[model samples]
Target: MKTQRGDIPRRLDTPDPAIRFYLFHGADEASSRSHATRLLKAFGAAKDAMEGGAIKSDPAKLADEANALSMFGGAKAIWIEPAADEIVAGVEALLEAPGAEHPTIAIAGALRKTSKLLKATEASPHALAHISYAPEGREYENIIEQLCREHGLAPAPGVVSRIAGMTANNRELARQEVEKYALYLGSGESDPVPLEDDVVDRLGAGTGDVAFFGLGDRAMVGDIAAVQEGVDAMSANGSEAITILRAMQRRIVMLAPMQARVAAGEPASAVISSMGRALFWKDKPVVTEMLMRWSAPRLARLGERITDLERRMMFTQLPAKSAIGEELLAVARIAQSARRR
Candidate 1:
């Protein structure tokens, strides 16, 4: 059976007994692995329950391992990550095996639309296939809210959006930020306090992937030196140029509404504080400064430009890294000009 991303959570938590295999593939490898882990937990399977292997190494061994009884006779599961075409025969063997009780999950990287392995898994009566993608807009916000709930947190009005803003392009970073926030909040025995804007500023600061490289913070503040440092770190760390651009795009999206509010004559501080309901407290001063430097009209233009840049990055064969670097430098120049004005 085929499952959509939205339905995967519910299905995993209440896994269908009929589904014996799952094929997870997408550009978002982190989400695929994380979802597979959730499914295993839901099925009362431990980490030890999974037999891990590579598709290129021993596709046939996958079935043998899954079929082989554990010393403790625990529930069986198989995890194959970064899979390739070599594993199709092994997967087929597992599918054809009689009385197979194990649940096998394959987490593959970017697959073609007509992937044979994916098609076969989805077509099977006892299997499921789900494609994970980077969440966008409200989808990521919902994920942030869900993460809060899991940690027994009741987020204050903009907390979810704030967290989502920080981690939109990266799932692994989102998980870590949410976990860190939950830990700060302590256990659920007592009535948990609603997450506050200042709390996010203090606790969630510098926790995101880009934040770790100091890119987002510097970009928002118009610090040329910091921006250069961030870009250098990104290249050194092998972060994709498109990924960095997407993060900047998300940052621009977050700024548009706040800029609109500021344009409407609300004090920059107040507008930023309200719209920044989830903004890190320490970062508030910087965001406020940026808001003051640019008018709503200018910010709106930048927003449009960012969208255009992201589209180009996604669609065109324009040297992505170079394009991203030029665009970022343009942004810094705008900030510098705004400062002069």
Candidate 2:
């Protein structure tokens, strides 16, 4: 039941009723999440929102919810934001239970190929699983176009690329911008209109500069001083701890598969080169060096630690900035040690 990212849109257009759950996981968690919601958006179906951790302790809770009767007498949809391996048993129960009245969607960050959650989801006949990497080139354009359509905008030619550029190719940004267009166009879920290029100009005129990702870049190269400096600057500039931590986690997700490829004996240069436009050309040199430095195991462990830190920031009353900053500095020290040995 593993689904390709390209086919996600078409499948959403005509979702299978027999499919009880959709698993969207990969490096591009934002995109994965947006896509997961598109299913509900498309059908105008409201979701019973839940966190991914809800079923970790009570494995049967997932199955119970799936079979629960909606008060409004409709098939309810369950949405689990930020899915993880802990929910594998719960998802297994949902899959095995007969006649799940609700469909479920679980969005996750990068998952290992052998992940129990991923494997269970893929193996289930009742679920569809997909991995989202950052989209590149034509795929980027396609994602924007699809978002516009889902949000009820009928963007004209050149409109998609302009929005893509204005949003700096961030799919989530592009999605939000398109929602603005839908509002401007007086468009609705069922009624669409011409989303001219001029509309992009009027609404997207003040789109801010792309976010700084140097904190992650420095951490990968084990530049402790730079990492600390970047964190200080960001904190002074009023950046949130969760935001900073999320950015670092993204770097971990982005490097993971490439590290694996290198661990499998592929040349780092070749793997980086093969990324084509998926990776920013300006960062290619640094990414290549880091890929050489961080092995697959290291990257995987780092990803887990970041995920745990991010979860704590969400669930606990922790000082976000300092905790996240400390994590990044620790990562830098580890990278520096790797350099020495």
> What's the CA RMSD for each of the models?
3.7, 10.4
lDDT scores of the candidates, listed in order = 0.70, 0.76
Which residue runs does candidate 1 get wrong by more than 4 Å? Answer: 48-58, 194-208, 212-214, 235-237, 240-243, 261-270, 273-281, 292-323, 338-341
Q: Weakest 10 consecutive residues, lDDT, candidate 1?
A: 47-56
Model 1 clash number = 2
What's the TM-score of each model vs. the native? 0.80, 0.57
Which regions of candidate 2 deviate over 4 angstroms? 145-162, 185-202, 205-341
Per-residue lDDT of candidate 2, residues 50-148 (tens digit): 766679889999989888888788666889987899898899988988878778989887787889999998888889998877665567788788887
For residues 168-213, write the lDDT of model 1, one tens digit per residue.
Answer: 5567677888788778878362566577776777887563344643
Error of 2 at 127 (Å): 1.3
Candidate closest to the true structure, highest TM-score: 1
